[model samples]
Target: MFCVSENLYLRDVKLSDSSIVAKWKNDPLIRELSIGLDTKITNENQESDIKKSIESKQPYYIISLKDSDRPIGYIRLNWMDNSERFGWLRFGLGEERGKGYSKEALSSFLQKVFSNDTHRIDAEVYAFNKISLNLLKSLGFIHEGTRRNAYYTKGSFFDVYTLGLLKGEFNYIKRDDK
Candidate 1:
């Protein structure tokens, strides 16, 4: 497991985790907003993906509640450029979508991202995804701008909003106290 909140842990997705991952992705409620893939989720797929995950030097974690230890969501921390100390994040929650955990989980991930001494953390979300937009804004990610029709899926390309948070912005969070 990986540490997200000060006392919370996030585990890596494993081949053994295929059942849960598939379940997480297959849930119509969760998949509608966060899914970026169209392929079927199988053990072979999970195994192959696990290899890629294991090979990456970046941070990736699965979200779980502090009380139940249930795998409710997943988060990925990766780079947009190799030369700069910068990255983007993608997140999904199976059953915890509206329970205020998105903000909590993101807060934790932001803390983790800044803790690594990085310069910036960015995100790109579909414009129609108001829940995600609000969640990110609530955590202080400034709306930088929009990438016009940057993502094509389902039928037409949708505009994606770009947002970012800086290391300095997280300085006021009472991390230890929380």
Candidate 2:
């Protein structure tokens, strides 16, 4: 599957993209904001994951510029609860940070997700990560609540903000309906 939004696009991740993904997964800034802050990732680990996830046809994608074959980030639709028509959302970008790439990629990805079996999508963000919080909020994700002291990192605990967005709540399509 693929999603194109303006100059950005999301495509199924290839095994060749594992190295860059592993690098981002191990970045200090990325790790501190992520749930698995304590765990470390290596290329070998990423390679193994790539192989298994490919076989399982996991819903993960590489984010790239529309005309480029190189990926600058990744996103995944995970833990699909068919009974609930919900999926857990996860995304990350590398050196491509500070750009609007993520915003565009996410907007497109969510549109694609909701067009199918997904009714709602959920995201967990570290309270300290203002960038992610703002991005989700700007995209219409509601603040469900916070898991107090849910994340432990840098020798301290931090709250985790839980955010959710229903398919009906997303305005990606209507924004251009006019």
Candidate 3:
């Protein structure tokens, strides 16, 4: 899948992206915010994961700068239903963090998902991840519930906020250029 935004584009993940992806996944900041295990992952391991993701037909895309087509981040949707309509969303930026790239990338990707007949998308954010929470909310995802002390990391427990956006609830206006 390919999606073009004003400043960025989302493209299918290739096996060649493993090294860079591994680098980003291993970053200290990324590890701190991620819900996944903090253990470092090898490029080979990331390639294996990418292979599995492709075989499973998951919506995994690299977010790249439109000008240079250089990948700076990734966004993926893991289906939670048998029909493949409901999914859990995950995304992270590499060196592009705090640059207003996420909002544009996510907005374009969410538009693509909804247009493809996706029913709903859910995202889990740790209570301390205020930036992510606000980003999701800005994109029309509602705060469904919260799991108190659901995750333990960084020597502390954190609440997990569950946010969901139904197709009917998504407020996106397709640009003429898209």
TM-score of each: 0.81, 0.89, 0.92
How high is the lDDT of residue 2 in model 1? 59
Q: Residues 1-178, candidate 3, lDDT per residue (tens digit)?
A: 4888888999999999999999999988777777455678899999999999999998899999989988999999999987889999999999988877888899899888888869999999988888899888888899999999998886888899999999988767445322
The lDDT for every candidate, in the order shown, is 0.72, 0.83, 0.88
Backbone clashes in model 1, listed as residue pairs: 2-10
lDDT of 1 at 117: 61
RMSD of 2: 2.7
lDDT of predicted model 2: 0.83
- After superposition of all CA atoms, the RMSD between model 3 and the true structure is 2.5
Ranking by lDDT: 3, 2, 1
What are the RMSDs of all candidates, in order?
Answer: 3.1, 2.7, 2.5
Candidate 2 lands at a TM-score of 0.89
Query: Which of 2 and 3 is ahead in TM-score?
Result: 3
For candidate 3, give the lDDT. 0.88
Candidates, ranked, TM-score: 3, 2, 1
